[model samples]
Target: MTVTTQPDYRCTPSPLHAILLAGTVPLFLGALLSDIAYYNSFQIQWTNFAAWLIAGGLLFAGLALLFALANLIRADRKAGRPVMYLVLLLVTWVLGLVNAFEHAKDAWAVMPSGLVLSVIVSVLAVITAWLGLSNLRSGGAR
Candidate 1:
């Protein structure tokens, strides 16, 4: 009997993965902003509409990430990592919206989920950009 391998899926960057590659940096910055927004002012400032806008943007970002993931996963052996990263980005994007709009009455009490998404987008920017570039390099994008 001949043995078959499951194909090499190690370290291949997915389009989504690359998108979130910049998230780590902004994550820290967002943390700082959240801290300031939460505890560093004499007056409280919050708005549901702003949060709603954030939710909408995050939703859009999630879609973009999903699109990138699909583009990177076209029967290629180097898309495993990128797929995982993209999924993570999707999850984070969804959670970002939830965190943004969970409480109708106490949105101010909640951290800016939009801030989280911004960070996500920022950090993932490089990764996603690279993944896209790599895909182009390989002519894997359809």
Candidate 2:
């Protein structure tokens, strides 16, 4: 009798996925900064900038979330970081959408809530990006 073993393979994000994931952090961070400026100066322009930045962040995070879902589906082991990453990305994308809606309101009305949402979304984006880009590997015999 002959014995055979399956080769070990690793699951990781593609280059494009990494780029999209990386893009979310900066855009969200920029939105957070804009929200801070708007809060401090009460400048409507700052709010406008924040809205645009949040939109861009949402776009990137949405794409990254799709990639994360794909990866989660493809991964052999889905119990650890992969599941957490997908959940975080989903939460970030959803909250980002809500923040966008909040920003759509009047500049003065966007205060407090919008800023709070921005802060949360920004932190989530950073965490999602970090989780997506880090060296998380799952390898085993197929």
Candidate 3:
């Protein structure tokens, strides 16, 4: 008797791609922290820090979104996990952009709304990172 096994071709991100996906969490979380600090201390510098961090987060998230798009295209079947991940990435990027615009307002005006958006964007970014980096493999058999 001959023993044969099927190969499992897992669809996963490359190391650099994974790094880009992972990078969004901290930058957004840092922005959230800055927003909180500004809310508490009423310091203008904190808003500046938050704005810069939001910009950085958007940069990384945009790169990761590109990678996710490539991954989705490279996928054998465009049905489940890849689609979901791509959607998540898109939502995160869009909301992050909105948060950036919100932060563009005056220091005092940025408050409350900016802080709320930061929290929501930060949560979305973390979820996107988690989903993108997790072991949710596509095009593989168990």
Off by over 4 Å in 2: 1-9, 139-142
CA lDDT scores, all candidates in order: 0.48, 0.87, 0.86
The TM-scores of all predictions, comma-separated, are 0.47, 0.88, 0.90
Tell me the tens digit of each residue's lDDT in model 3 across 1-142.
9997655556668898899888899999999999999999999999999999999998998998898888778777776777888998899899899999999998799989999999998898888777778766665543
Number of backbone collisions per candidate, in order?
13, 0, 0
Candidate 3 stretches with Cα past 4 Å from truth are: 1-9, 140-142
- As for model 1, its CA RMSD to the true structure in angstroms is 7.5
Candidate 1 residues 52-129, lDDT tens each? 444454654566676656656663544354564566556656655554554233645544544554456445543544
Question: Model 3 misses residue 25 by how many Å?
Answer: 0.4
User: Candidate 2, residues 39-128: lDDT per residue as tens digits?
Assistant: 899889999999999999988888888888887787777766778889989999999999999999996999999999999999999888
Better of 1 and 2 by lDDT: 2
Off by over 4 Å in 1: 1-35, 46-53, 73-75, 111-142
